[model samples]
Each structure stands twice: as structure tokens, then as C-alpha cells.
Target: MSGTVSDYLLYRLNQWGVRRLYGYPGDGINGILGALGRNSEFQFIQARHEEMAAFMACAHAKFTGEPGVCLATSGPGAIHLLNGLYDAKLDHQPVVAIVGQQKSMGLGGHYQQEVDLPVLFKDVASEYTVMVSHPSAIRHAVDRALRIARAERTVTCIIIPNDVQESPYQRPPQVHGSIHSSVGYSEPRVVPKEQDLRRAAQVLNEGKKVAMLVGAGALNAADEIIEVADLLGAGVAKALLGKAVLPDELPFVTGSIGLLGTKPSWDMMMGCDTLLMVGTSFPYSEFLPPEGLARGVQIDLDGRMLAIRYPMEVPLTGDSQETLRALIPLLKRKEDRSWRDSIEKNVRQWWKVAEGQAMKEANPINPQRVVWELSPKLPDGVILAADSGSAANWFARDLKIRKGMMASLSGNLATMGCGVPYAIGAKFAYPERPVIALVGDGAMQMNGNAELVTVAKYWKEWKDPRFIILVLNNRDLNMVTWEQRVLAGDPKFPASQDLPDFPYARYAESIGLRGIRVDKPEQIARAWDEALSANRPVVLEAYVDPDVPPLPPHITLEQAKHFAEALFKGDEKAAGVVSQSIKAMVEQLKPHKS
Candidate 1:
């Protein structure tokens, strides 16, 4: 009650259950930093870069469903937090960013580190963006920002001037109680109307072959999803964000959809008569069934997103779990299992082809094999974070997410370098669980590698830390290279996609962490074993074969022709790329005896 405004803000944050703050120290934020140091309730987590601090905060919110807090100094530091804050915004995670501004008196004259942060962050933190001018207004601004962020699941910005932060708290008797008394949101159960549920069930019952596409919103409704799938005799395909919504081993559930998906998921979407979309706004409309090919029924909590991706005949607005529960009783059970069985068979066959691809011994090492080997080695309830490029493809196609396991990537933003920071945040949230980061060589060097020192700094503080970063060292932007050949019909340009090969393992070791490099297929398991057993943080760099392409589940004639064009253009790796594509085609076309 007698402390400075900064202390009051920290106390309010503590009341809201925010125990840790991720940020970097700077002159503009010295007052708040001092307050953070004085308070034993909140732990200050320092990062090498302000960007990583925001990334760590976003990841913490993503893993825990709680509003994560981050801070930064004025100017460049505040600007650096934009990318990570956008990641949280697009993903609809709750995060509050506190930025330091130039002293209150230095407003219009253009001080050294002055930047209009409120105007700059307008789009990212559209929910709430306020500059705390008076000390008495701190509680109101903090409470509103925290409430909106939690209730609406958005990014909120609170800017405090350097001088104002150190000012005395002017708490009036009118607003005396702590934030705990007034900081809560509505928790009403959203369920669809009975008539709407009945109508949705009617549409689903009429279709003989129904396919379900689910996303992150359907994660908590896994059991209901399985029940609905069973009742409708449907084959389920998951968007990348919803990869862990259902267990990978589910017989009737195909894996991820779109380019980073299994063959069965593609086939299910193309062959289904009705598409039952649940909680997914998958951006790629082309990957979905043709406009008239299938009737659609969509279920989502946000009605605005309903029928936005594909045309829906029945759009039900409600929570995924409650909506599914209400509709299940009215749904008619389908007796025929032919459609579901065929999709399951394809899923199983795809796994075989995938295994062959993952296990194939190549010149350097198959990138797929790194993820394949790492899959079985992961401890139970492990939290996995994958970068946005080729690493995501491997994680999507090869990594099998069990029920207890958790995994995420930059789903909507698809940004690189989030893997390392995400793993660090996950480790902080769940120290008992093993945390792994699957990053491409380019992404690791881009932003992930720098965060290793942050991990080293905090490694000793954790009770039982098991942080592992698996770098897919292919010495090229492999995903972009494949995109160039397949999507753009261009030959592999020498200086365009190629990246310099760095000693990631040695770098990790130099930072006082364990490091292991694997150039051969046989050494992968050993390297993983060493990394996992190490007491401190570990980096296992695998020299993956850059020639291996991340081929989609289904390849069209246009794509084939594109590859042919690339080969005709005298691309060095064209022949190998063609060979891999042909092999995949043959396996997909192989006859199923059943």
C-alpha cells in the first residue's frame, strides 16, 4: 500500500497469478526492474534479446492458457517485441506486454529512444493499449488490460514512463481493494440451441461418407470428437494446430491436413460427401474439397469464423465440447464402415511409406530419421515445440503425439525461430516435463541459437530440467528450396536458398551446455541418449541431407511438370528429387488387397 506505482503494478500481477516476468533490463525500465527485483513473488527471466522475451511470454501463455507478461525498454527494445506479440495475437493467446517509454517530460521533442509505441502496437494489441500517465490510474489500466486479455484471449499493451514508474502510489480510498476482488471473467457454458443441434445432426445423418476437420479449439473436446466420429462413421483430418487434438494412433483419424499432412488425410478430404468442420479456420481453401463436391456443417465458438473457410450448410455456434455433446444424441449412427475403413487403411499404408522415408540411409543423414528416432526416445508427457519450416513438416508427418504429449508451432504466423523460446517457456511452465525444440539449421541460427544462453542462465534454477534442442542441420533453407522446385517451377539457385554450415554443437558446448553432433544415421540415437541424460541443457545437431524434399501427401500433374521443368533446367538435385517423388507415387498407388 505504501510502495511506488511500479510495486503496485507488480503486486496486481502477482494477485492475478503471474509469478514470472520475461524481459531484458534497460535504462527506460530501471524503475520497474528494481521493483521486480525487490518483490520475491515474481521471478524476472532475462533473455538475450527483447524479441525472445516476447516469444517466451507468448509460449508460456500458449502452454498454460494463462496471460503471460513481458517487458521491454523504449525504442528498439519495444519494437523488437512486435514479432513475438503478433505471434501471440494471431494465435489468440493471452499476453500482456509492459513497455518503457521516455520520461514523461520528454514526450514531443523526440528523445533518443522515443517511438510512438501505442500507435505502433495498435494493430497487434487492438484489445487494449494504454499509456499510464498518472499513478492513481495504474490500478484501473492494469485491471482492465488483464481482464480483457484473459476474458477475450488477446494481447494487451501497458506503457509506463520511466519517471512515472518511480513516482509514489496515489491510491485513493475509492479504489482500495486488490485486483483479486475485481479480476475475473464470465464462465458461461456456450451450447447451441436444440433446434440448431437437431438440424446439424440431420445434415450429418444424411451423408454416407462424412469427414471431420478439427483445429486447436477442438482439443478439449477430444472424447466428444471421437464419439461424433464413431456415430457418423467419419474419417477425421486435423489441421496442424489441432495435430494433438486426437491421438495419432486412432484408427479412423487421419493425421494433419494440407501440405504437411498424411496421404490418408488428403484422400479423406477428396473422397468425402460431407465435410464436418469443427473449430478450424484452415487458411488453405484449395486443400479442402471442391465447392460442390461436399456439403458442409461447421461447429465453432466464434460464429464469425463459421462458413468463412468453406461453405457450410449448417453452421452451429457454441463451444466444441458442449455443441458436440448436444448434437451426439440426435445424430443417427451409420452402419457402414467401408469409408472409414478405407481411410484407416490408407493411414496405415502412409505410415509404412513414412517409415521407409524416415529410415532411409542417405549421404549425410535423412532429416526424417532424426525426428523418427527422437519420437520413441521422448519421455512421457513431453512438451515439443517445432520451428516453422522443414522442421515443422517432419514434426507434422513423422512425430506421433500421444495423449499426454503436447506440441505447437507458429500455426497462423508460421514464423521461424520460435522453437527454442517456446521450449524454454514450456520448461518454465512444466519443469517436471521434458521439453524439446525441433528447429531447422537456418531457424536455429536465425533466432533460436541466441536463446541458448538464456537457457544456460536459468538451467540451474529448475528443479529437474530436461531441455533438448534438435537442430536439423541441412545447410540450406530446405523448405524454401523444395517450394522453389515444386511451387515456382524454378531450378535450385546457388546463392538463394543455401546457408552457411555452423558448428551448432560446439557453440552449445561453449555456452556451458552439453552438445552432440551427428553426421551418420547410427549416431543419432547415441547423440539423443547423451543429450537426454545430460544434467544441463543440450543441443544435438544432426547433419541432415538437404537433398531430401518434403513432398506432400498427394502430388498433382502440375507439380510433376514443375519438377520436370526444374530437372530440365539442369538443377543438380533434380534427379534425386524426381526419384523421391516417383517412389512416393508408386507407394501411394500400391494396391490394398483388402
Candidate 2:
């Protein structure tokens, strides 16, 4: 009276609340994929590559606050899953990675698809465990793995042996213990006294170049923080993860600050004599110049992050939203609009010079232009998951993100295949809102974006189209050679670009999805329209110049100097170019000339 192991797995997965499994199928894992197809609640997302599938699942977990799941066959297939799984671990996403093992007996004997997955994934997984040979023990191990992934907010790699996967008579899945979000509730750490808010307000009232800096923890207080900034005529800049905290058009916002920060943001941070660090644990203490440069005050839910980096003159411990409300009334009337106008001017003209060029440029299409086209078309508050390299730069410079449109562009960890998978996570979290997975063809191919099929299969059963992927298909390692030639100072820097002309568009189309490819400038709109109209997964292959760089709004005097010293060292033209960028930054800091 027993059924196939595949059917049992499907039933168990449904019980585990895994509506989607992003993966590619092979001999070891084909049984699971076929079983996935048979079920109504569970579906397989056949990824273009193992990494993308893992990345997609990671994205699903980030938003959903659940354990995102991905599957891969043994050996090389499982090896490709590492990059994205590691990315998930760093980004604080919970993903359950299932790798098909060779067999229980030949595990260490070195078969065709043999790899000690448990050992390989030990460091990456917050928890690692192997599957049970007995059908009765299967559900508990899986349930336990899911718990570890969610509770620890890290990846959990589980090795399912080929025999176990192909076996029959396994028990059905069930909810064992409690499953909940990792959102911690520390003891009311922020009980900001009335006097603290009063003092913080006093500082804001008196300062000339007053500014606000927001981080991930403070993201929830966006509106109230905006209100406080408006009252004091302050400028705003964000930590890396806080880029989308406010609307791109906000008057007081300068941009981000760090190694990847905009020049104007650095200038404004230096310009301001006083700063407010609201709800953030920005750890770049060295970047925040010495204590004399500015007097900083911070408000945070986690008091530990308040002064962890830079020392604070006035530290107000309270809930970000509550603290802002309590302090709003104590602010004195400040009449100067110059600082606000300065940032506005900087944001406006810089885009005009940089992104404007990209938008209007003709043939040998610009990547920036593709992103620019996307910005206006996306719904307000759309969460965009951007990858690293030229692709990240293009979207950062050209995409006009609105307030509350959360985006996470990880630092040099720069995992290329993160975009499409991240979109899956964000979509899982906010199913009602639009989530776009943006990436370049080079990076996509590197990470293996074939995971779209995995998502498509999942969507078919769930009847949800939470993922929309827009790929800039330049068909080469565009960013790699560009960084070497442009940033790395290798004039004779030979490009590492080598890619095949595959039918990426046709591939997506075959799977009951929408695919559009635009090689020419004029075709962008029509292709975009076709992709946008579909209420399912959309694959947009925008062919742009393989070597263009995405420049920020303003390059500072300090930054330009560094660039000259590093790249142009003895060259006058490089120095002149650096000089011009500084001049532009200075002009940016000026009052509105327009």
C-alpha cells in the first residue's frame, strides 16, 4: 500500500510550506523534478544553471522570511550551487539547499556524481545534515533542516542520496515545531527619555549643514524621517543597503557613502557639521572621518549599532519611528533651503549629464539607457534586486527608485548571479508588489540563469507571477574587461569576453513565458511592452555596448584625486578628467543655479 518516494516527497514538501523548488534536473535529481511536476502544491523551477536556481530560492527566502529551497544534482551541479548559497548566507536569507548525492553506499567510493556535499557546504550552512535511508526518518530531517535555516537565517545544505530519492514508501511531511521569522525582539532597548529627544532636536535646530543618514534598521521609519529632514532643511545619504530608503527625487538626499558611494554624498557628509544616524548599524567606522569633521547623533532600535562605528555626541536610544515623532515638535524653525537645493541640483544635473547621455545615445546601445527605460515603467515601490559589476552600475545610475523601493546591492561580494534569485526572495516576501530581477548577460551566464524554468513551474501550480527578470544581454564578460581597461589601468588590457549567440529569447518562450530580445535602440520599447504585458515571468534580453561604464552623479575632489593617483598616475589627461569631475562636484554643492 506504499506509493513512490517522489510522491511522498511532494506531499512532505507541501506540508513543509515549500510551494516552489528552484533547480535543474539530472539523473540523481530527475526523480524529484518529475515528482514535483505531479503535485499541485509543489512545482519545480528548472533553472538555466544551478547557481541561478539557488540564487532565486535565496531571494524568495529574503522576502518571505522562510527557508527558500533549491535542488541540484551531484558533483558539478552541486558545486555551482555554492556561490548563491554563500550569497544567501551573507545577505541574511534562509535557504534550504537540497543536493542529490550519488548513493548512500557509494558516497565515499567516488562515483560519477560524487562529492561530499556535507563537507563542502559545512562552512556555508548554518546547519548541515544528511538524509535518512529509512523512509520513516525522512520527514523529521527535512523539518529539522528547514527550522535550522529559518532560525539561524542562513543556508542549510541537505544531502539526499540518489537511492533515498528514488525509493518508495516514504511517510508524508508534517509541521513539527513552530516556524517563524528571525526578526528578533530585543528587550525595549530604545526607551529614549524626553530630554534626549529634546537635546537631539536642539542640535538639529542650531546646525547649518544638517543631514540625515539612514541604514537598513531605520528603513521602516522612512516617512517620519522624511518629515524630520524637511523640517530642518537637511540633506540625506544612505549606507549601501539604504540606497532605496528614499525616493531618488527627494530634495535633501545626496546619495550613498562608502567605497562605492557618490561624490556628492561624501561632500555633503563632509559639508555638514552635524549628522543624524537614524536606525542603522553602518559598520564603516573608518570611512566616517575623525570626530572633529562632524558632530554626529544617532537613533537606533539596536543600541549596539548606534555608536559601534563612530562615537556619538548625543545618542538617543528609541524606536526609529517613535523617536522621530517625539523629536519632530522640538525642532526650531530653520529658513535656509540652500543645502536641500544643493543636493537637488546635484541629483538633477548629474543625471542630466550622465544618464541623459545614456538615454539619448544611438547605436551600440547603452546599458544605462535600458535601465532608464525601465525606471519610469516600474510600479512605485517596486523592489529591485541588482547584481554586481557594470550591470549594478547601470541600474544604480539610471534606475530612478522611489521612496520605500528597497534594494540590496551587496558590496564586493559582488556575486554575479544574485539578481534573478534575489528577485524571487523579494517576491516571496512581498507578493503584492512588483519585483524585478535585473542582471547583465555576462553575469547571468556566469551564474547560470536557466533557473527561470524552476520559477515558471512553481508559478503554474501556485498561480502567482511574482518574478519579472530583465536581463541586459550584452553577450560577453563586458564588466570584467571594462574594469581592467578602465579601472585597473590596463590599456592593452585584452577583453575576456567570449560568449555564444544562443536563443535565450526562444528558450524562455518555449516554457510558457514571455521573452523579448532587443539588439537595436528602436526595438527596446516594443520588446519592453511585450515583456511587461505578460502576467508571468518575463525575460528581457537587452543587447547593449559591451564596454560602457556607469558613472555616478558627482565625483568628489578626494575621489578624483584617488582615481588620478591610482589609474592615471603620471598621465595629464587622466588628471584633467579627474579635475573636471571635482569641478562638477563643486558646482553640484553650489546653490541652485537653475
**Best prediction by lDDT:** 1
lDDT of 2: 0.68
> For model 1, which pairs clash?
none
> Against the correct fold, how does model 1 do in TM-score?
0.96
Clashes of 2: 16
Worst lDDT run of 10 residues, candidate 1, spans 172-181
Model 2: worst 10 consecutive residues (lDDT sum) = 178-187
What lDDT tens digits, residue by residue, belong to model 1 across residues 481-508? Answer: 8888888888888798889989999999
For candidate 2, what is the TM-score? 0.73
TM-score of each: 0.96, 0.73
Candidate 2: lDDT of 333? 60
